[model samples]
Target: MKLLLDFFPIVLFFVAFKLWGIYVATGVAIAATVAQIAWLRYSTGKVEPMQWLSLGIIVVFGGATILAHDETFIKWKPTVLYWLMGGALAIGLLGFRKNLLKSVMGAQLELPETAWRAMTWSWVLFFAVMGVLNLWVAFHFDTATWVNFKLFGGLGLMAVFVIGQALYLGRYVKDGKEVPVEKP
Candidate 1:
């Protein structure tokens, strides 16, 4: 349910790209993202910060793509978003001594403070790497390839990361209960 909602914009963008081209695809993406936010707000009465950020980026970058008649701006959107998220997480960890990931998922998954910190750092690193990866692909590959990478590569990497995180935290899942424990 939530996963489908999350992918709605990307899927629409992919389809639009196949049928039309980057400009039309960008426009479709913008619309899909806006619709996603609207639907989420209507259904849940609240929009997540990430969703809002994504919406803003798509609107600005996609709009620029359309208005400027250039695809570079749209291509940089994912990298920018990724870097921003990583930056925010880094600030929370280093500046405030807070694990943002734990703050978000703590209610569902309990782990030792050390584990939480490790997970937070892992995510920070992951986002940073993904940002770089996006830019690398964008610059090296053609627009069509970059678009495919955006939908498939980005999502694939994220799925792998989440799966790896789940496996890493499996040890802490205590008989179907979430119990935070420190490693001695």
Candidate 2:
């Protein structure tokens, strides 16, 4: 359900492109993105920061594609989005603080602060890798291949990485214990 909800706009883009034209597809994708975001806000009472940023990028690049009648804008969207996010994550690590990853994921995970810090660093690096990968594939591959990668490659890679992370996290669990409750 979450995947479908998140992917609704991209799907709309593809379908609209096929049915109407590139401009129409861009418009449809924008509309779908906005509608989905509104629905999310209404139902959930909170919106993710990432979602807003994504919407902004879609509007800018997708809208540019429509207005300029050029596909390059849409092609650049992923590269820009991922790099922006990755750069933010990487830059934000300059400050000293409690475990960054643990702060966000702590409710679901119990790990030493050191481990959490390492995980956070890994995520920072991973996003950078994803951004570079997006740029590489989008520029190097054919349009159809790029589109396919955009729609499928990302989710597949994410699923694999997440499963791998789960496995790694599982290994870090100690002494057959549940998520820890620290002593008062």
Best by TM-score: 1
TM-score of each: 0.95, 0.84
Candidate 2's TM-score reads 0.84
- For model 1, how does the per-residue alpha-carbon lDDT over 114-139 read when each residue is reduced to its tens digit? 78888888988999999999999999
Alpha-carbon lDDT, every model: 0.92, 0.78
- Superposed Cα deviation of residue 156, candidate 2 (Å): 1.0
Candidate 1, residue 95: how far the Cα is off, in Å? 1.2
| Model 2, span 16-112: residue lDDT tens | 7767766787789889999989999999988788899999999999899988989889888887887776666556666555455565687877776
Lowest summed lDDT across 10 adjacent residues in model 1 is found at 175-184
Which parts of model 2 are misplaced by more than 4 Å?
Answer: 17-22, 96-100, 174-184
Clashing pairs in 1: none
